[model samples]
Target chain A: MEDQDYSPKSRRRFLRKFGSLGLGTLAVSTGLTESCTNPTKDLESGKKITLLNSKNELVEVDSAYISNLNKDLAPNHNSESRKGLPGKKFVLVVDLAKCKNARKCMDKCQAVHQLRPDQHHLNVLLMKDSEHTAPYYMPKHCQHCDNPPCVKVCPVDATFKRSDGIVLIDNERCIGCRFCIAACPYSARSFNWVEPKDAEKYKDVAYDIEKNVPQKKGTVTKCTFSADCLRDGKLPYCVSACPNGVYYFGNEYEDAVTNGTSGETVSLSELLAQNSAYRLMEDLGTAPSVYYLPPKDRTLIPEIEDTHS
Target chain B: MARLNTIVAILIFACSLGAFSQTTAWEVSADQATKKNPLEILPKNLALGRNIFKRTCVSCHGEKADGKGLIQSTNLIDEKFQKQTDGVVFYKIITGRDKMPPFGAMLKEDEIWSVINYLRVLVDPSAIPPPKNVKLELTTGEEIKSITAIVLSADSAKLPLNEVDVHFYVKREFGLMRIGEMSNYTGADGKVKVVFPEKIVGDSEGNVTLVVKIENNFLYNDIETTAVKKWGTPLLSHEDEFNRRALWGARDKSPVWLLLLANGIIAIVWAVIVYVIYNLFRIKKAGRIFIK
Candidate 1:
């Protein structure tokens, strides 16, 4: 016998509720404004954005279908969010005494930034002075200079200094002229020649400057200091990733620095004073936020012989 | 004289051909064929031989240890194939012909002897006694994590081991996973000491049980001993905020001197250019009147 109880009218009522619920989800996920009436209709007619599906295969989805969930798995920067967190002055100290070129910081920073293979947001350079002098490992990131030359040459004001001691790049606004790259004495900036694999994977997500993700082709990117992680009251990726007690990060206002490798908290001023910290290229008057303690009386011998550029 | 030399060469070539034709069948001399394996045909030797055979000879001779390998022309398990002496087998493996590749250059003589012992086991399991007397005892320092594993014989006398591959494994959900490997010959004391690092401590509580094992050894049984100890501090993964004060932070000054100097130079240059332009205009006007 044919079942007559499952009627079309009830099924239509269930679908109507289900459709509204889906619209509600879409509204919340996209952070869409209240004015976006008929969200589902707009999504149906929206432009398609290519992105990798759960299976890691490229698939075309509506631009509105893009969510932060996919983008937050790994992160990047765009052209907005130039404002710094109020009352925060970020500073980094590299204790050269502890670094053994484990390269954990480099690996972690690269992973979180989703940097291309050729690009390095943080570089660990092997340095040796003379044949008689001992060798040491020096890891360099964006100096985030107070009087950044990169900022001065940026014709469109795409790269700017923040109040919180961070030099950020608005990738979307960059014309890829590479003027800032030339101006930067520290060689801190990296110009994207092509769309990176990470950007291709999360193609649907709208780019965020703070996250420094969904990186665009023909744009510039540098070490963002993981500003989003900082906002979440967390250590920068490089700070936590180091196995050796190399990087020290804290707010200058707090006057305290925490060592990620040893999990030790110490007064910022005391440590810097005792170590005789100095900034790289100080004569240039870039006034860099990062300071370094000279590698002396090292815990272990520098075993790496060759210095890679 | 040339014809005489040619005749001599022809005679020599004929003699060589005759010698080869007369032999016909290749054979090992009775003295060489009767030689026995020098290595003891114990379970340990058999196991080592089996491991080597599985890695190197499994492709040619199938997993079943029979001649039914990928290119099977000979049956090793057959009574007729097994009838050959150990020396004969060893010679054939070293100097191969027809389809088989020569393994003399690839494997050591002792390894080949082990393979022969393994083959013997396949033919008769009961012939070789299992290694029951060899024992391994592992002891570790709770505070320092200095691990010492001693190998002993049946009479409780220490046995010197050479070139042994000892593996230390920690017990995980799915059997044992190897943590570290050490290759060292024991001195006259028969003890191997290793100091585990403070960072690789197993769990949060620092409660770790290590299973020390000797693998692919011929002298002793593949024995394992475990020792629980409080060794090292477990690595804690967390986020920490750090700060440093330098001359880099934003100051209220705004480089007033530099700004004033730059603007002052610009103002002077612009003033001169504007005055020059005005004079040039006036001259042009005067020139027009003069022409009229």
Candidate 2:
């Protein structure tokens, strides 16, 4: 007997309800869009659109497919509901006095952002010189710059600066051209290659459009400055990930910060002063969000250098 | 002199023999009609041959069959395009007398045989003569990363270290020594896994220093990062991290934000100061009158 008991209309409706709440992920490796064969607008001509099955590729029926790009992901700009997630601003100061590139924060950020292990918004890099120079792992991530080069080069205005001064990317409109990658001096941008293999296994992640979604393959990506976490009144992923207290997060309104993982608070200015805070590329004038106090007056020189690197 | 004499003989034989015999054997097929012999074949005309081949035959024929090369591989091994072709091979490429994409579209009849002759010389290793000179260009960036792995190299010393306490001492006259630990032995290949609790900070040029010492192995002693060039420095991935590090938040520290919060308080204080200045004027006048 053929299993055609259900009508076509019922099956269509069944798929529509899947992942409708915008939290649970239902996207497969095939990138099956909910309405696989429906189009709302055209990208080139800008008119009502329709999509019927074409040979094998899912090309836009008309040129109008390029319009309303931000309609799907990152509605923070297009959708009225999330117009102003954070009205004020946020800041943090890292105490380099107590850092050793543990890499826990980087791991946590990867998990929360649904980033592939290699495609992280955070990085702990090892700095080396001639054959005999000292080595150290330098941790870095999206600067959320006051003057973001990624924002300047985006042709579609896909990335923008919020009123609160945090720079965010609207991944929906990103052309995936990688121009922003070139413009960023800090190298903060990451690309979503191969449909985000990690986002699928963790089905429990509450999807937020601003976090740039099932971080699709073939588009530019970067740290959101953990704005979505700020919206939900939760701490950013990198802050608490640190075990040795490399990262700090707090509202600029509070005049203080707490280690993301520990909940211990400190005065931002005092912490920076006591630790001798310095910005990564102060010469280029990007004004990065991440600060590092110098690691000075150390006792035993690190011997396990060849090992941890 | 003998090599030169041999080359002259081969060129003479090949030029006189014509192009048809070689292409079919090597599978060199004529793809275009306009292609012709040495009157037509030159290094500048390679594009015409390339276009003709691409449109008619690429799918099953495979790209330019230097074997390992596809269109995108940028394969350098087969880049020696000059090694194969001679005037005879160019004729067979023009005339599709064999299994090849015949470009009868726009070429004159005689031109086909000529092109076939030129193309065969390109594919056959024995045909085209050697080049006069060879030079290479290369570019590279500085290597900053200190990679961690098992050193199977015969030069390394395999130390058996386990369950050790580390005493990290600051270099000072009466240097303060702090204690930390891995609580385990160095793993295989004499590897002591140092799980850094905090992220290390590097200079603007991506440089830093680390001082490490294990308390358990006093004889091995503290390894100052200054000793090992690869020790403290981490190699940043070539791409994104350079861009992301350039940011702080919307505001500086919150005390600055708290100062913003005290806007009304500051305004009130300003008003009080103005009032005090006015009262001071009155008092000065009153004092002057009382003095009088």
Candidate 3:
């Protein structure tokens, strides 16, 4: 091989042959093809495998490759993204009394998700409907409605309601139609009209709809209630990142919602009753998982300029 | 053909050289490159760095820092990455290139250095020394609102470790809720005293799981000790409030009027279906008699 003469044309031909036949044989002999086989068993044995990933690249025993193998490989929501934690019902309570339009929650959510400059998973809007009523900042995201209009209108089952009360969009199954975006009454969903600027960064990452990072173009992305962190017994980014203790997140089954700022775990029902918690557009009967308390006692008269509707 | 082979070899050599030179470009001044890390590289620093990494870089750098992150970028475990000077790595992190966002704006300098120290440990596990043989003892006095925690070497006669910062925490549902931190150096008697605030209370049982942690020590492995005591006001009021709340469309929340109307509608629809079936059978019998 050292003595052999080489030319550019001959090198190309050699590479072509080596890439197809030699690599293919390497893939087969190494049992890399087993990823498409008994993936769960292979995963348990800690066996390394090389297989074609969703991006059509040959990946080793890596997360990007594992994500593409099959959802059946793991029934857990951390990987499958659609399923919820068994026997768990998630709920959020935003105390309007605490919010001062600080927008720390929105900033943290954007930073974590690598959201587009215009698109925000958590939107903090200002409401002063009448002269009689005072203004308050309302942070809104996907309510994860039990009777979700978006889920009902979706032509494909791409957008689904998980058992834990999270509404997630499977970018792989979405056909770029904006039916779900239109169906939403709260304007929670945002569309990626063009390839996100950070798309190249996620080129090698396997998609986990629950985390909603490495956002794909032409697909709808919304707040996933930080399902990934919840799996690890951690609070969602927006909840923990808030400075004013505006957000409370917990499992309804546990009947407690820990405020991010104070680290105070309050009974979900008691908090709702004491604060008069109400959901957005309740008359529509969407039955949202997120509830909001009236912004009765003001923390600060929010600077009106900072408010985005 | 021979000339082409020579050219190919030259190209490979040149490409390698280019990659080598690029790493050198990241190097700071000689003094800065050799500068020691101001912050101690202990498990505490690593833990803080780990938290920051989870929030900031996990999406791109991955949980294991293998560069298999959801937003795939650099494989932190790459041998080339491990070989870079601490200063060089720190510079690269602060001033990111295309695809890699600049973290300098978001993270403080100390935090960036901490992350680099963490990356160092990841590259070489031996960088973090093994756990030292230190035993931690925590106890509460007659008053539940106060406690005494002590640290000593397990093998020796309880020699007090002075100037060690002991952290007090209340265990929350999701994670440890750090109520406050007190820097206490152990006294001559091998004891550091901590007072629990009246506010750091627990559940309805008047119980709080207090965690005392001594971290960032150069001499010892991080020690985390916990104690459950009857202290502080009851944080929780009612656990069974959810049993009958009119919320979240639970069965109890179903309106009586709506339930009655729905049941009535179902009865009417079923009754009409049964009548139609009865009429169809009689019509069939009448048709047979006429035919006969």
Give the per-residue lDDT of model 2 (tens digit) for A15-70: 34432433222122122242334422232364523432212223223332222322
Q: Itemize residue pairs with steric clashes in candidate 3.
A: none
> Which rank order by TM-score, best down to worst?
3, 1, 2
Give the poorly placed runs of model 2, Cα more than 4 Å off.
A1-87, A129-133, A198-207, A297-309, B1-292
Q: Which candidate comes out best when scored by lDDT?
A: 3
The reply for model 3, stretches above 4 Å from the true place, is: A1-79, A303-309, B1-172, B176-292
What DockQ does predicted model 3 obtain? 0.05
Residue A94 of model 3, lDDT score: 90
Q: Across residues B44-115, which tens digit of lDDT does each residue of candidate 2 receive?
A: 233234334333333224455333311122121253534434432344334434223234544654444433
What's the true lDDT of residue B222 in model 1?
A: 72
After superposition, which runs of candidate 1 have C-alpha atoms over 4 Å from their true positions?
Answer: A1-80, A304-309, B1-292
RMSD (Cα, Å) for all candidates, in order, is: 18.0, 26.2, 18.0
**Interface RMSD per candidate:** 18.2, 24.8, 10.0
Can you give the DockQ of every candidate in the order shown?
A: 0.02, 0.01, 0.05
Better of 2 and 3 by lDDT: 3
Write the residue-wise lDDT of candidate 3 on B1-292 in tens digits.
9999999999999999988876664446677667666777787677667556655666557778888753356898789888878877777777665456456776899888888888887777776767676788987786446777788877867677664556667766665655454346567666777677655446666687888877645346678988888775665533243233333233443467767788899999999999999999999999999999
- Tell me how far the alpha carbon of residue B263 in candidate 2 is from the true structure, in angstroms, after superposition: 41
